[model samples]
Target: MGISDTSTGILKGLVVIAAVFIVLAGLKTATNILVPFLLSVFIAVICNPLIAKASEYKIPKALSVTLVIVLFLAIALSIAGLVGNSLNELSQQLPQYRTQLNEEFAWVTNKLAEYNIAISSAVLIEYFDPAAAMGLAADMLSGLGGVMANLFLIIITVVFMLFEASSLPKKLHYALDDPEMRLSQIDRFLQSVNHYLAIKTVVSIGTGVAVSLMLWVIGLDFFLLWGVLAFLLNYIPNIGSIIAAVPAMSLAILQLGPAAAGGIGLGYMVINTVMGNMIEPRFMGRGLGLSTLVVFLSLIFWGWLFGTVGMLLSVPLTMIIKIGLESSEEGRWFAIMLSSDDDVEKYHTAK
Candidate 1:
């Protein structure tokens, strides 16, 4: 290419980068507004099936919506109560754990000293504060606190979204020129999202329950809190499972001996491996999957833009973008680039 052509292309790339930065900045700034709406959209998607099932029995739409909302509120309230009780107990018992934590720290320092690698207890304490692990868990809970604060707004938004969802296809038909094609694309996207959320919910619940049972059997403190963390973080790919395990494992080490802690860690690994690696893929299949790199990048990008809720919704949001891109004539190439090799090959083969 000519120098002038290369310069023009570079300028266009810079413009696109700047535009993306601006959009991200806006999203971060308006998080209070956007987070609720995004959450509502997801809630609406998840609850739509329940509403449909209720309606299939000739139930009125208002009654169906009310039934779904009531069920959702009951579940939310139960989780809130569990988490609140767990945190209250944890705060009261933290002083007891601190002594055990210090003992463990000393043991580690002594082990390192055996190799002629002397480390001071002060330095070790400074470097590894057990409270920090609790802080991490607290931060996750705090994020949930933010969501709970906005619960009413989110619920209202979901109710409206559900009502609009039924009429959306007709609205799109009149608004778009190629109504059939557009409706088909939208339907496919919704179906993909619904299926993914349903399967992921089941798998996450299984992981959480299994982990909680294992922790209980192993005599760990705050098993319910850890189980809830696992359920929530399981929404994020890769590092999420590790994040969920660290706090529980740290508590295990403090409460039990190293051997028991190791067993607890092993239990986490097996549960995550079985549920995330084995079971998820069978249900998710190739079509709904993103490239591994894309998954990581989406986690970082969305987390940066919208915080923890964004991280939780990252994969689904990226999937929606990919679906939208694939439906457009000019954007299909971008979608293909976001797909795994297997998916890319399938797309090409279909072409």
Candidate 2:
């Protein structure tokens, strides 16, 4: 290629990068509006299966949607009330939890000193703060709780989206110049996203329930809160379960001693293993198209940009983009870049 061609290419790349930055900046600025809408979309997508099943049974779309939404609201409200109460109780009891942490740290420091380790209890307490772990969980969930104040707006949005979903294909057919290919791609994207979110959310619920039950059986404080934390964080790939376990395990150490903490850790391991490694894939049928590295990076990037909700929606958001890219010949390379090796191999094989 000519030097002028190279120069033009460089200019185009620069322009594209600048455009991306501009869009990201706009999104970040609009986060307050964006997060609720995205949350509503998430809810709407998951509820689609119920709507479809209802339709299959010859149930009217309006009645089915109303029923599904009512069910959703009931569950959401119950979780919010319970978690809110748990957080309040936790805040009230934090002083005692902190005192227990100090005693636990002192005992550890004393034991270490017996072996000539000479670590200060203050140093130990500072680094291994159970309250910090709980605070992290609290901060993450509190972000969700804050969004719940706009629950009415979200419900309306979800209702509209659900109603529109049935007509979107027909709309696209009339709207697009070449509808067939576009419709096929849109259908693929919707089916993949819906199946993924549904299965993953169910697995997450299982993970949370299992964790809460184990914690309760072990007599850990704030078991319900930790369970909810597990459910929310499970949306994040790879490291989410670890993050969820930290606070609960820390509390277990402070309240129930190291043995109970060990048991709690073991329970988390088994629950995550069975759910993530075994059950999730069995239901999901294949890997998420994005690479493991991409998943982790998106979690950090989205979390940084949008906080906890961003982290929670990171994989879903990235998967949506990857699928969108794959819909066009020109964009498939970019999609492949976002994909796992297995996905890349399949893409090539299919091509």
Which candidate ranks first by TM-score, i.e. highest? 1
In the range 283-350, model 2's lDDT, one tens digit per residue, is 66563777779989999989877877898888878888888798778998899999887788998899
TM-score for each predicted model, relative to the true structure:
0.92, 0.91
Error of 2 at 100 (Å): 2.8
Per-residue error (Å), model 2, residue 318: 1.7
lDDT of 1: 0.86
Candidate 1 Cα outliers beyond 4 Å, as residue runs: 1-10, 103-120
Model 1 clash count equals: 0
Residue 333's C-alpha lDDT in candidate 2? 88
Error of 2 at 3 (Å): 1.9
For residues 125-207, write the lDDT of model 1, one tens digit per residue. 77766678678878877887888898999999999988887887788999998899888888887888888888888998998
